[model samples]
Target chain A: MTNQQCGTSRIAGCQFTLHPMSDNFVDIILSALDEVDSTKVWKDTDDVTTCVRGKMVHVFDVTKAIFLHAAKTGEHVAMSGTFSIGCPGDNEADVYMAESDEPMNLEKSQTIDQQAGCKFSLYPLGREDYMDKIYEQIDLSKARGVEVSASHYMTRLDGDVKDIFNAIEESFVAVQEKVSHTTMTFTISANSPSNK
Target chain B: MTNQQCGTSRIAGCQFTLHPMSDNFVDIILSALDEVDSTKVWKDTDDVTTCVRGKMVHVFDVTKAIFLHAAKTGEHVAMSGTFSIGCPGDNEADVYMAESDEPMNLEKSQTIDQQAGCKFSLYPLGREDYMDKIYEQIDLSKARGVEVSASHYMTRLDGDVKDIFNAIEESFVAVQEKVSHTTMTFTISANSPSNK
Candidate 1:
């Protein structure tokens, strides 16, 4: 079922998993989780994924903080996340829907110096000119100083962690403006031994 | 660039990450890696994802084997994978492209008893009736005995691991016949505490 009209309940959420390549991965993961200020969003962690649901800004803010904190540990860390908006029947109660737009951990995460490589695919569901929109975002990411390349099933991005997240967040927001239901799936890797 | 013509090269690959929700995750991951016979594919392991490239059958076979083995250990395991075919400029030298179609570890993997919960999204790049194709696959999955439901940004499938993999593989193959370039991203969870 396609939802053509954007409903008043603009629900947004992200389901993500973080993997750290180290013997002390558990410590790294738990410590990173502790660093994030997730009080602003409805957060739940299951055996498979950690999901945060609420306002768009808060959702992105929490996911970004978790990844940044893990990456700052200097251990190879990788995160896969799916961000979605405008699902057909996703009218869940959101107590934090009216939360302030300010990101809780932005200042702390910004100070972390980590380089990240990312790949993402954006789905602008039911749009005819989907490729045009996809290419436009690729161009926009490049203009924002994130190295963009064409990869199998995804667009590759390489840059500082902050810049990469900014480019991703901006492209996702841009597509939401034109398409009623849009989703982006992305993988970000930092502190990898394979880095050139 | 969307490749309209399905080239003879027929490149296929899957990049995936496996997460075991246990303190001994590294052991589980390493032991599972040992179970998969990956000689028929071009396999590479980087910091974030392990990639298997070549013929579509072998690619899926290896990825499935790894996940099944880890799940059979009675540990909560979750895997995220992206499968893609017909990418532009993907003419890498596939040494085992001419390998036999039989999956290397099919018999062994079938013996494992594991239940899996999966969510997947498919993108027929540049296709006009993409939603129709996606809906068709959803109905097809339900018909094939996989419990299909709608979730945020993905279609959910809950069933035995074998049936779930079969539905996914069949859907991917079906899309290839119509769309020149097709990609599917899926997350599968086994032995998850959140399962009903």
Candidate 2:
């Protein structure tokens, strides 16, 4: 998966925002940030979102950690994130591409207990059979034990937070194997009043 | 657009989640919902998201109003939503297809003054030249006076809340003119601590 072979850089990254449904949202957000070990990825926080760039595994590892950490606080939390790989002309984060694939926060994240409901859409850019790829991933999602259903423009996933995240991460990584440039956008909600 | 021509339904809908960064999030969310005029659209709220289905114009009108109303309260607010049209096998919402084009809440939404920062990704599914459509819309977004810039997995947009929503709505409708199945995912944030 070299840049030259795909005409797009192999570096993967995610830009995500966390919203905690509490007046103390700032505390929840900051505290969650404090718990995640993001050293393996190149991270920057801006006014709108925080972006983590590096190996695909590391990017998912850190973003998943941030969300799980926030959810463990027992507050209603929602995370919106976009993950991309094989972005054309995206060389700015190439330095992090050399980082190892080992995830720094997976062990800690696995211990968090929470339920999540999510909806996601995947774009395998430039593929004529994009629907086939999307449907394939949907099938995989159901096999992973997350309750799956079709909704307008996206797929709904419901289950334990860990299982839900695993389904998302696996499908994302699996799609990248065949498509050089792929991007997915998703929103995960936990402990919402509507759920009660 | 007819279902027979596109092999998909013409019904447009949006599933959205609004997160207000305050302990009184429930009040903020409910208050904003109360202020919106959603009579033109079919709306249903569940544990994770609120789905509004109807004519495209009304769908955007309601979602944009809810976000703007929440932002007007001067509290930090973020909205995550997916706007989709031409979804195959989505006949459940076909009843909304008969709604009028008139937007029910446009005039009132215009009165809200707030700045917003947003990131969005558009998917014109099953098109080989999908990138062209996406880049064209990026150009359109710029022409609308919103600050546009490329980011990982999505494009960043910044401007007054109304202008931001307008750019998004226009671009979304523009693409639907050429492609039958299109879906867009976006995140809009206002009054964040990071911005301060």
Which stretches of model 2 miss by more than 4 angstroms? A1-7, A141-145, B1-7, B141-145
Best by DockQ: 2
Error of 1 at B100 (Å): 3.3
Candidate 1 chain B, run of 10 with poorest lDDT? B1-10
Docking class of 2: acceptable
Give a tens-digit lDDT track for model 1, residues A145-189.
677765555666788888888888888888777765677888888
lDDT of 2 by residue, A65-128 (tens): 9999999989999998878887766667577888877888988988887888987777777787
How many clashes show up per model? Answer: 0, 3
Estimate the TM-score for candidate 2. Answer: 0.91
Off by over 4 Å in 1: A1-10, A20-35, A72-76, A86-97, A140-150, A191-196, B1-10, B20-34, B72-76, B86-97, B140-150, B191-196
lDDT winner: 2
Task: Report the error of model 1 at residue B165, Å.
Answer: 1.3
lDDT of 2 by residue, B1-196 (tens): 1111113667788878898988889999999999999988889887778889888989999999999999999999999888878876556757777877888888898788888888877878778777777666544535465887665667778888888888888889888887778878788999887752
Fnat, 2 decimals, each candidate: 0.16, 0.41
lDDT of 2 at B127: 83
